[model samples]
Target chain A: MGMKLDEALVRARRALDKPAEFGPDLNVSEFAVVTGGNELALSRGRDRLSLVGVDLSDENRAGSYYQVDESVVGISAKMPGLTVLPFEHAIEEGIIENYVWELVPPDLDKYTALNAIYGRRGYVVVAERKRKIREPVQACLFMSSPGGIQVPHNVIIAEEGSELSVYTGCTIMPEVVGLHVGVTEIYVKHGAKVNFVMIHAWNEDAHVRPRTAVLVEEGGTYVEHYINMAPVASLQARPRVTLAGREAKAHLSSVIVAKGRSLMDFGGLIRLEGEETRGEIVSRVIAKDFARTTSRLRLEANGIGCRGHTECNGLMLSKRAQILTIPELLSSVSDAELTHEAAVGKLKEEEIYYLTARGIKRKEAISMLVRGFMNVRIEGLPSKLRRQIDLAIAMAAAGL
Target chain B: MRMTALYVRNLFVRSSGEKMILKNVSLELYSGERVLLLGPNGSGKSSLIQTIMGNPKYEVVSGEIYLNSERITDLPTEDRVSRGLGVIFQMSPVIRGISLRDLLVKVSKRSGVSLEDVRAVADELNATHLLDRSLNQGFSGGEMKKAELLLLFAQNPKIALIDEIDSGVDVDSLNSVGKVFQRLFSDENRTLLIVTHTGHIARYVGVNTAYVMINGRIVCKGDPKRILETIFKEGFNKCLECVGVGDEAR
Candidate 1:
């Protein structure tokens, strides 16, 4: 029997009957439309319904450069009427639990929606989907509210034996007030694989609180490389992962360049829960011109036959720049193999002399080595992403 | 007199929290001269070479080192390289995260040479195949030496301080390396100061002058034939106690 619109609306309402202090204004029954014409209306309707029209837009998102238009559409069970979420949702008696959404957009604004959701006390707003998407998802998080506060929630789930790549970035409007707090939780299911690249080049004053947590199932692998080349003064991020399955693995790589009195804190963790799990975490931080940076790593292996390696290295270019590295490894399994290394200092004068003896200038030599150190992790990235990251690094290092 | 390749006077070096490695030592090398420094393990031969190259690890207590009449003991290593100072280290060179081709290209560009010229030099040093790989990474012993030689040739330094050029090299590598040295010394104004204890290197590199160092001081100086003959028969112990006059009287 064909259901009536009233019945469908009632079903949707019942689906969203969960406890919400202040919802995004869902008083009317909106249809989950994918068409271009209806998508703008839907966006506008969402803004109006949520009383967020004063700051948000309703433009339809275009596909990523690598993907054709209208590739795929995702709808969330909680926001079933909105039509696009990142994970799969199953409706229970009156609410949806264990919901994982994947939002792969062609442009950058999807990141903005994510920020809006989390910025305004939106709960469990995961910005990414779990499925292995062939097309690239482009997202942009632009802070145009002028001192507006935002805390975005994003969860990434890679199912068993699946593969996915994500590219996300953030941009802040000038004189924008408030804070940008982002939390991301990643799950790599058994034998699954996920690669995440996040580019943080926000405005200088933007305070970003970015946190990521990942779980790896048996035989699954998760690789996350973050490039924090922004000139932002106050930025702190921690991307953590738990190897929960046998033979599960995770690698967290990051490169941070802080300059000009900026205070940056970079930290991450890798935990092995199952037997034979492997995890590697590497980080590089360069501070110059009175900047202060701290890079830390925490590795915990509980299961037998687990392996973990963590390294945190820092380079201080100026006399005023201060850098600290804290590397730790905790293992309960007798068979677990763990190693941690930390080093912080200026370039060895002998090394500079050696380079100069080859006719290289002192400044040029130091710049080359320091910049090269920052790009070492890019060697393992995909070609296109790696190139973009390299460009970004050069720009940041040049202080441009 | 024409400008010599290198000159040192009143050289003194001391290790950190340790005794002096070299005290008031003096040496000089004219253009195109192949010089050898023979010594026991504790001698300051390596220290002298690094000091001349301006290694920051070694502070010049009281000495004046000149390269072509220009004092450069205070300059950075890259500046020394610019002034025609090439070195073949005893151990591996630090590997940078760039392609060998780019490294060679960088050296060539700074040296005012064409890219093809760099390529030709790389080919001459048998490092052509390694140029596409990362700079000095995962290279075998022979290959690393060859790459070092290519870099040296690209720099085209007037003075070369070679530390144990024959160590860790097998017979086959010894011959190839010997031929390169022969070519390197063929041109005047490109001097070399080789440091080694083993006399087998004599068959590979033809030396014009030789000096034996013991206990941070040069004990004797002589022609290559006499030094090799003496070192082969008596070793560093008996030679340390002998004066340059004769082997018999104390």
Candidate 2:
């Protein structure tokens, strides 16, 4: 059940002064809530949607949800098997009350606290039982109001034996100073599968903190891919996924292009909590041009005959850039198998030489290597979405 | 007389750490000619090939290299490769992110070799399985050599400097690779300088001239049949003894 507004308000005030465990705390009071920007994020904003990977005139998507600063601007569902709605609307319909603040705590940190206080704009997507939706449900969170503050909470549910995919793109305008705090909760029922891809393209003067958590039941699978190739002043996020039933699986992969004096801390954690369950986390980071990033991946095995692994890889592209990777594996039972591997270094000189020797120019060869390094092939992804991810990888490799 | 395809004059080479590797070496390969460089182990034959290919790991301390009678001792590896100087290295490095198909796609554009031809060559060499794999990761010895040959075939360079093409190869793989070498040498306009210590490649391709290098110096240059027969009969010790007494033949 959804908590009342006064109780959430109390928790928000308690953690209002709480500093995050990573990155410097931005003064939340500097950014005031501005409501009436009246900007349709779809097309009039000079192709900002495409930059974050939303086609302006795409017919392949099953549905779309668009938000502009604290207001729901567009919601369209082309198929009858899916339900897409704004957060306040979903709450009013009593369709997603038990899912809000279910996976993520309201007062975990200042960002989540702020989201609990003022988060009524994000979308909620639900796939009915045994309904297979091939096309991805696309969502866009656009921030165009300068010096504005946005707090949104998102919820997604996949019923039993259903298959669904969602692509969420978060972006800001060319020259906007904003603060974005988004909290997301996802649930995958028995025998259902969900593939989620979230891409962020914020400008240089933005502060972004996104909190997300996922849960999978018996025989269900959940795959999540997060990519952020643009610049941000301060970015911090560490999403966790839990396999809560037998034979459940989860795959979490993230690619970050840290550049332009940016401070970024990225992470993913997978917990195997059921018998015969499996989980994996992979992170790829490319640091360049005076940027600093620390990536962490953790896997925990707490069930009988359970298995988990983590791979944390980072590449440094600049002499002044820095990257640090930490991989942790925890096993509680005697039969629980957990392993991890971490590597952080620059591109190999021999690999570059090999390509150049084949008559490819040095610049083109380096670009290819960087693009390959950032790619993480998600299994069973639709070809249409795979091409968009490839474009995103190419754009990220070209430069931020 | 045919035009000289590759020429090395008074060449002195050093490793990246400033230690000398090849000393005062001189050689030549004319267009449409196949020359075999037979040397003992650690005789600096591979170093010479590396120097000729403009690998920065091996620097030219002193001398000149001319490709197609044009001086190119000061050019970068990228420039030299674009000018049709191909090679099958003694050891192929592992390029983690690049696939054989990816490499061959670019080479096909430059060398004008169609993908159909590449597929045919790969099928003959049993290398079609490696087209989608990373350049050389987890490849067996035979597979590595075959991959190198596949790339050089797509390259179709003006001059091919093959190093140890016969080493660490099985009889079955050698048979397939020998077929590729024969096809490559069938072009009368192309040039070749094959380096091998075992002289196993002699069974496949004919050698017009042969040289035996010892202690970083070419001590003998003569007819291929005679030199190989002598080396096989009496062993390399005799050559070393003759050179120690300063009675080596050239």
Candidate 3:
């Protein structure tokens, strides 16, 4: 079960030379498959994780999953009616038989194909039927091996009438050159709810590609929040979610920070497919230094009485930095409502004057504004996790 | 001799667009004195206060400004603020991220006002709900004036330039704001330059001198009660006896 050479391997081989439709292409052969980690992961990994606001020792979390390179280092679940396990372990135990790549396919892209073949190290989270776990579950992936490739396939399932919350942080050690391709699929069954928060931090030498898809059934709610604050060489992610059942709802909020020569292309798409379903995609981006970002969010309404909205806002901090915001909305039914709004510009001078006139230094005023622009105020997050995210946003704003 | 807390002499001001907004304006605000600069719309009364506060939007093309006898014509807005200059713009722009509490703390740096002290002032002003919110974000007209007053209180400046503070405020809010003005006037160290078009604030706040501007020039200055009586009788009319003809405000 280590590696597959069947149709999965064939798909990986055929799409090995394929390039992503969005973001800069990464050379697949440029990185070595990380096979092991040195003593630093055993000794100082927690310290490095803490730098990005990842806390495993917090008792408020229902469970925690830690993965370094290609290995799953730690996994646990503290509450009943909840299951958290590594991808391989969950596969062996048959917990992800229906959720594994059911929403996201291998042929979607070269990265997904590679993930289906070499990405056996990730997390699996499942909430049993009618079980609403109050505490948030934590998952983290660490890419520390230099010039290495770390592929992870993550699956989350909230069974019928169940509720689950997860916070996933992907980070790397200082100055480590790595390529991380992560694939995730989330399933929200009837009357279930899922809150997923994924934050990534990396040095300037890393390139990341994350592929995710979510499906929300009838009377279910799916909320996703994504943030990438560290200076990465490049990051390209466009996760799509479908509201598949009547009265299903999905809200996707993304915070993107591009600095220090980083190139970030991030977007989200929400599809309202069922009657009376609703969806929204909101994104905020801060581009500084020589960084450049293209932020796009799209919403589609296909069923009667369904409505969707998409908004993309970007702030440019430097003359050399560039930001592009694209908002797309589509409605196939006459009764469906679709709207979009996009704005990409620098910090308003009136806002700066408002603070500077308050006796605050101009630089500090700009920093405060930058931090506020990055604040999305995600909904339905636990207090402990929300505090961690707030701290992380503050630290990221200060880093500039 | 009385100390001039804020002295502006022959100040010709222009906006960032190079349009002249203030022409040959001169005023003297003595310590412990609250003055009302009254005018109608487009009369440049707010421009005078903004020029004194060193808003980069309005540039002093010539002449000089002094605060507490120190030349501050060339200082930036932050420096002027640190020198005990406080102002509440007629319409404070929505600051997306900076909270009122954060701005209060930053502005109160020289005044040594702690966060608790700011909180206390917010409570007194009935603006505690705005303490944690982003400055001026989604605030009603009344809430905007109240929040600006809270910020001014946090600074506790020696000179306060309040523009149209009573315009959008309700009667209750005006009472609270008037109380804050009274507190400032109770001390001998504060100079007040309250700018208004309606001049209705005179009923709530006390002012020593009332200066009426027909266009960009101060045409008349006298006892607050007399000026009010004259203006209320005739409206913002041309007082050519004390001043000459002038152009419309920029």
Candidate 4:
């Protein structure tokens, strides 16, 4: 089922040329270079790499939407595994396997690798990864080259009754033309469960565009969470999932932190097509230091006894920081219940005063409040992941 | 006679380049003495208490304060509290997520005091019922004052600076608070510096001497019953005659 890997490389390079026109030197990491080929291999000292790309359609067919930049390095599945496919791969393979594709920015692009380029820019896996992977597969895409881009295509399939978790994050090295645009897709089988988390933090002057889509089978459950921590830039992405099977459940949560001239256009979409399906969408954003953010949520319920809920909360730290939230719900079945809510405001003075009265200084008071706000989500994550996330948040807050 | 348990000399408090709120206000506390500070609104009684507690918001222009022969004017709030000093703020300190019993336990442990003593004080102050509740969270004004009493009982500091325990308190709360103070100030080594405007607290909680403050200066000092009666009958006008306005509070 593995076609000529070189053709995919050629097609991806053409897409890379679009962003390359502004400045060829920007192309630090070349996507066409093959670092290592196997089920998975760690590459070091790469300028450009593309992680994954989806056909942007169900039938793995290829067209203009199939093109992506040099960040995602193209490679063949040397090992016989999941025979995975990008959204486009699904179209071409004629396998209606559940997956999603997105055109996210460079910062989000780094999310598909390990430590955002501690070694190489990104990674790719081609294995028959069916529902057996209990641990959430985490891929961190890190870019070391300045003004370079990475496109990663990630695919996960839960075989019948198999459960899995997937976490992906993107970080950029300093002065690097940090641009990462990525797409991811998750497929849950009958009675299977999948939890997906995406943490996005980009350097200043970086752009992020990420899209994700998931499909849940009969009695399957899916939980998706996206965290955006970017610096003085823009993040445009939409993660959507469909509960298409009977008794399927879907929960989506998102957090976005924008500071210093940063602009974020973030949102999520959920569809409940199965009977007795349940769906929840929660989003939070904090904008500070002359930053602007917009959050939107859309949910659809079509089956009897289906339920959907959406909430968007925004906290503006500085006067110049701006936020806009939109929460929308759609229900076709009368038996389904759908609700939506949205709010935007600054830190509460009473909460700050409360901490200060505890003998905490004013600055320390503010920091503790801010830490408390972020800790809500931090506490929910696993211990090791929470530590790394906290370090990154602290660095970003300090304007590093 | 016990030496001065607390002594403040030439104390001046200022904020934002302004004149001292407490202009050269000075006073002395002796062991086993409960001194009540009386003054009109903004007359510097609370300011005096805050300065002695080392609240960072108020800057002392020139002043020196001592507790049991050791100067504490330059100490931080926690350090002052560490040095056998306990204060109950005028406004109830609102706390959250910390249960009353847990906070009492933490304060006792940090103070290097016995938990059994804290428990006994909690029982005496009727705070045992509140042990399950969060510290000062959702507490009424009266309840919050009682919480302060509970803390003071558990702390058992050598010097206690109590601010407005009678203000905004019901009769029952006042009685309980007074009893708590009696238990706390039972030892001869303990000194009480209480700030209040009402004479009723003096009636309920006996004090050795009363200081009448007018516009930041301690204008008069006499027996608690006499000064409180004078202030009630004549207001601050009588205080002006006792100390010439020409001189600062000291």
Tell me the alpha-carbon RMSD of every candidate: 9.4, 2.4, 3.1, 10.3
DockQ of each: 0.48, 0.57, 0.71, 0.10
Local distance difference test values of all predictions, in order: 0.63, 0.85, 0.83, 0.63
Q: Model 4: what TM-score? A: 0.57
TM-score of 2: 0.94
Ranking by DockQ: 3, 2, 1, 4
Better of 2 and 4 by TM-score: 2
Interface RMSD for every prediction, one decimal? 2.2, 1.6, 1.1, 5.1
Residue A281 lDDT in model 1?
A: 87
Off by over 4 Å in 4: A1-136, A144-149, A218-220, A245-249, A272-278, A301-311, A331-343, A377-381, A398-400, B1-250
Candidate 2's displacement at residue A19, Å, is 1.7
List TM-score (chain A only) for every prediction: 0.70, 0.97, 0.95, 0.70
**Candidate 2's residue-wise lDDT over A267-349, tens digit each?**
98888999999898889999999989988788888889988878888899899999988788888889988888888888877
Scored against the true structure, residue A129 in model 3 reaches a CA lDDT of 99
Lowest lDDT sum, 10 consecutive residues, model 3 chain A, at A1-10
Docking quality band of candidate 2, CAPRI definitions: medium
Tell me what TM-score chain A of model 3 achieves: 0.95
Which digits, one per residue and each the tens of the lDDT, describe model 3 over residues B1-250? 8878889999899988777888888888898788988888988987887788777789788999999899999998889988888888898888766678777777677578676877876787888898778778889898898888888877888788989988988888888877765664577667788888777666665678878776687777777777676667767674444332222221
- Work out the TM-score per prediction: 0.75, 0.94, 0.94, 0.57
lDDT of 4: 0.63
Model 3, C-alpha of B189: deviation from truth (Å):
3.4
Return the top candidate by DockQ: 3
- Put down candidate 2 lDDT per residue, B81-103, tens digits, no spaces: 88888888889887765688888
